[model samples]
Target: TMYELVGKEMTDKWTPPWPFGKKPTILQLDELGMTDVPQAERVNDAIDDAKVETAVLQDILPDVGFGFGSGRAVGSNNWVIGGNTTKSGMPLLANDPHLGIQMPSIWYVVGLHCKPIDGSPPFDVTGFALSSSPGVIIGHNSHIAWGVTNVNPDVFDLYRIKVNPANPLQYEWNGAWRDIKVRQETINFGDGQSPVTIQVRETHLGPIINDNKVDKETGEIQGFNNKDPMALHWTALESGTILKAVTGLNEATNWEEFREALKYWDVPSQNFVYADVKGNVGYQTPGRIPIRAKHHSGLLPVPGWTNEFEWQGFIPFDKLPTVFNPKRGYVATANQAVVPLEYYDMLASELGEGENYAISQEWDYGYRGQRIIELLEKLAPHSIETLQVLQGDNKLISAEELIPYLGRLRFNEPELNEARDWLMKWDYQFDMDSPQAALYAEFWMQLANNLFGDQLPEQIKLEGWAREMWAAYLLMEQPNDTWWDDASTSDVVETRDDILVRSFREGYNNAVATLGNDRSRWRWGNLHTSTFVSNPLGRSGVSFIEKMVNRGPYPTSGCTGTVNNTRWTVHSGSFAVDHLPSMRMIVDLGDLTRSVAIHTTGQSGHPYSKHYDDMIELWRNIKYHPMLWTRAQVEAAAANKLILKPAN
Candidate 1:
């Protein structure tokens, strides 16, 4: 019966698939119960491939019910500048999707086995994807590899429609007139499932975003396609599913095929990062990009029904903009603006330009991108291992100008001085034993809270605070010009100022009281902790905290916003009920032909089993083992494996 329904009122009836809306399934338990990222089954056999889209996900619900747990679609950030590539010489690709949710995690860690349908050797396509979908969502097969981070481009716009009181169906468009399209879908909730009905309307631009009437108490956002309603014609609606395209690409044999697969990329924009077994790397803006004439909807909503503001076309792939592998060896992106002003001028004839204030407003990409690039450039002999370490580095920081003032606090209070001794005696590395790092971080946050109660001030925030005085301080401290390059490369930088004596004194007092005046009491792991929860049917909870393991790699160490971070937890959604990304992997596609991989969880989401939450302890510990490479290996490494043949 579930298979019988295809595109049958999906947007209204699909209630989203998950057990008890939170637990993992039996298949999930079979695959994920492990201490490391599992290797693919090295089988010499192959089976008839199923149409993944058709066979894997069958939304049985009647109406187009929102699939996202929080009713949110997607979120992530990634960018690949023109600098880093392997050999074939292309712009490196990178992406990060910030899908908001709570618990178990949406990402599935899988290493699928495949025997080329074309009569080639079978190899594993290791990657991550939604559990229901088959194929590597973000990983390398043998020929090509890729990753996705959200584009976070602003595409949806609200319009305030001026409706005809006489005929509610008609609204004025442009200077002339037009009638909006109206439609309705009946939702069959099933026998005793409570059938329902839903009303939907559309316009030339897109769907009616808000309800026809506004809620006085709730301030609910309503939509009607007048010259003034939220008109949403995102690149996602017209294009292909990024997931499907990626799966197909995993089976691709060459770049031409890979690019062709990318051509189908649908909604929810992404900055793609690609690396092939051939060492060819490339980046692409892989979503439908609107070619708007004049800039509108920056400050306020634009009027719909106006022909003056419809999207003409999308940016073509070649013209979508990219820089291939540069002479330089490394590239990085943390969601910063891809194009500079000069580049924009070269692209559009009448580039969307208006209100200088609106133009200057920061478009999402904050200090993270700039920070990642600066750090990468400084580390010349860039290796993947270094990149991993960089992800978790924590360079000490504070107001540069205030370092001296901060230094004075230690002299002022004996208790504060104890904290300073612990901090001063250390290199700014975020080692688990480095109690000073935690103390410093806590103090920094406290100082931040004191200075900027909620959000940091425009110019004087921690980010700006470091840069302004850095050039001057670097010139003075080392005085060598090369010092600038070396100093800048660090994933993090140390601040030289201590303007907040009160914060120092306060934190010093708190730190000493808890940690004791002796340096023995000043470890960060003791203070800084990670809280994890298990939310099944009704409520949310937390049983896991920061684990202490002074071994191979660190946990949540290094720098915040640094490229290499051990503490990569996908904690998203409302605090009362959150949606967390279940897995975080650091894979190694050695030569892209065959490789090693590791992820938090195995291949499932079912609870009450070994694999369900098995990866939790391993992930929390920042320790991983080898993936299963064969049936023998899997049988040996895995707690157990089971087969669930789908009933025909």
Candidate 2:
């Protein structure tokens, strides 16, 4: 596990042997605002202490929600390579950050040109920029192009704090009682409605997310009787100047300047891929990388009263996983376990391994990264078009790996037998028109649940795409495991074949009942179509208002871990796409004008504008448009131009 390796490295107390010596800067315990209790441990204890069944515990769990700036779980993919590896003798960079499909879209194309000052040359930067954010998030200057993918580092910790028995407003931390800060917030709905006021409290650890208070008679507070208060401690609270780093990125002309800009970037850590016109390429994982103490897994909540679990310090910036001009020719990242194994071993060797620590344990199941690497290895002298093709590639490796196993199953039922034969004869690509894709998806989902649904507790039962992925691994590698058996059935142990046949029959019957009996008409796109609508307005009482304003119901290919990831979710009663790549960009350093990009929706947010949904069909067809680097190109492509003038 990534955490195990990181823990081993930390226990060893090995530091990166960079040229610069270790600095004295360390985060104070108070600065971290950590509570003395571990959140997970506290929550687990509460769940165990509950008298009700585990299934009902879901309702008891606090409904923690994501804020506007929260980072997504493992999905984005980015890559960059040296010019020597490309056809045009220029570096190639591609990025398709996976974000939720939204109506105004998440990005806007922007070009900035600063006039020359002093002896410095004028700078030209262009690419995608977020709505209110100051600079281009993933873009290119005249000298270099760069992109980003999420780097899953464990930067957030939850601490459980012991409430002072004498005073409800105090918490024990570091052997002392500290009064929690309290604030009253009143939310007004206006329109003559009364305001609702709530009291918010903060412990030394952070904000008290859920205070552990149990009603004596009911033995429940809100829902389950929580044992202790838990406060969230995240590195983002003290993140460095991200805006400054982004602004610098727009002007950075070389690898050195680019890297220098990244020094100020410290929140929502990313895998930064770099490619310069100078023919150099590099990869860096940057953020406030936490250095956990010995014996701490960084998983469960730890006691806040002791300093042992506090972060020693951030990993040295230079020490964070980095590679410059590797012999592999290209660098790719897809939110996978990116820190090399050798780095962990080196750290373990340096520091004696008696303690435990962790960097991160969450990573995407490297299907996208694996597929991209395979294509890169085969395609030397690659072009921007080559990359564009690779970006749109919908080869379902997950299905490919498991389809053969499903085909070998001999089913007793006619529908099950027919479905197995159909899967065996079909190609594994998750193209929109493939009926086989739909069948395979359903089979995978059903078989997964059948195999392991009973094995797991109701609270943690695997479901959706995650379940399918896990089932693929288990069926392929550990088919003989007792997990395949249905625990409810007595005196009958289900074998892999027994489970496979039963799951197929069940899935086939469900598919027929829902989608009808015409196998030829069972198109994956019919059910898996992507949508982009103004969610708020669409749900409004005014029906015709938003219906005329939305875009999509467009056919798309791919599944959760594929290159073109268009995922389906349970909406209403049926499946609909809830996630997909929001944009795609391919930069060719040899010629800036030749670079191309396309977002899911068009440039404008206005519903009636010609540009609003113009790109929908193009995007659905898996196409790209000229990025328009030069002023002339942008002007030529402009439908309506606006010139701002200074007013006297």
TM-score of every model? 0.64, 0.84
In the range 349-387, model 2's lDDT, one tens digit per residue, is: 444343322445444556677688778877777998788
Query: Predicted candidate 2: what Cα RMSD to the true structure?
Result: 8.9
Off by over 4 Å in 2: 1-74, 117-123, 186-195, 212-227, 348-357, 461-463, 466-468, 487-492, 569-574
lDDT of 2 at 47: 19
Residue-pair clashes per candidate, as listed? 82, 13
lDDT, candidate 2, at 70: 15
Q: Ten consecutive residues with minimal summed lDDT in candidate 1? A: 43-52
Task: Return model 1's CA RMSD, one decimal.
Answer: 16.0
Q: How many backbone collisions does model 2 have?
A: 13
Local lDDT at 282 for model 2: 83
For candidate 1, lDDT tens digit of each residue in 222-333?
4343343454554444546767676567777666677777777655555566665555555665656655544442223456657665665666665554534433443444
